[model samples]
Target: MEFRVLGAVEATADGAPVDLGSRKQRLVLAVLLLDAGRPVSRDRLVDLLWPADPPASARGTVQALVSRIRAVFRAAGGPELVTEGPGY
Candidate 1:
């Protein structure tokens, strides 16, 4: 799988485009990709996802979003989403 973050944040598998879901989902993916092999803490994700004011359930929301992203990539036979410690 190849990911393009240069413009519009796109993902391609086997030469075909992959649907990355909503804007926030794409944002999450972008954050992960930017970090690449590094781990991004849940707190950091919350800050990035909701810069203005994060809700009480921000952590849970991030988890849910990560789950959805993992499922999408898994179904596409793409890269594995690894969870290490408190981050994804």
Candidate 2:
């Protein structure tokens, strides 16, 4: 799988475009990509996403979004793109 983030956040497989879902999902993916091989904590994601005001369920929301992204990558034949440890 190939990812493009220069302008639009995009992912492609075998020259075919992959649907990355909502704007929030794209944003999450962008952050992870920008971080590359580093782990991004849930707190960091919540901060990056909400900044001023994060909801009580921000962490759960982040997990859901990340799970969806993982499904997308899995369908695209991506090689274990996002892994969970201390973070994603």
Candidate 3:
């Protein structure tokens, strides 16, 4: 699969378009791609995905977003791109 993020975020698998899921999922991937090869903190992801009032389920929402993004990358035949570590 190939990912295009220099412009709008897009993913393709075997030359066919691959859906990355929802808008929030795409945003999560977009932010991570902007800082590719690095660890993006969960807090930062929360901030980017929910700038204003965050729901009580915000953490779960972020987790789901990350999982979906990871699935998209895997479906595109790419390596696990987002790695979580210290402060990330």
Candidate 4:
């Protein structure tokens, strides 16, 4: 599987295009790809998604979005990705 983040957030599996879902979902995927091999805390994702004023459920939303992204990757034959941990 490969990802294209230069123009639009896109992924391909064996030369077939993978649907990245909504804009926000694509953004989340982009962040994960941009920071591949590094631990991207949930808080950091929430901040990047809603820097001005995050809703009370910002973290949860990020989790859901990430989950959806994982599903897409899984369907694309990609390995398990996007692990969760802790941060201050």
Best by lDDT: 1
What local lDDT score does residue 6 receive in model 4, on the 0 to 100 scale? 100
By TM-score rank, best first, the candidates go 1, 2, 4, 3
What is the clash tally of candidate 4? 0
Q: Can you give the TM-score per candidate against the true fold?
A: 0.95, 0.93, 0.83, 0.91
The most accurate candidate by TM-score is 1
Candidate 2 structure quality by residue, lDDT tens digits, 1-88: 9999999999999999999999989999999999988998888989999999999999999999999998998999875755567589
Q: RMSD (Cα, Å) of candidate 3? A: 2.0
lDDT of 1: 0.92
Each prediction's RMSD over C-alphas, in Å, is 0.8, 1.2, 2.0, 2.0
Error at 32, model 3, angstroms: 0.7
- Predicted structure 4, TM vs. truth: 0.91
Indicate the TM-score of model 2: 0.93
TM-score of 3: 0.83
Weakest lDDT window of 10 consecutive positions for candidate 3: 79-88
**Per lDDT, what order, best first?**
1, 2, 4, 3
Q: Cα miss at 22, model 3 (Å)?
A: 0.4
Sliding window of 10 residues with minimal summed lDDT for model 4: 79-88
lDDT agreement of model 2 with the native? 0.90
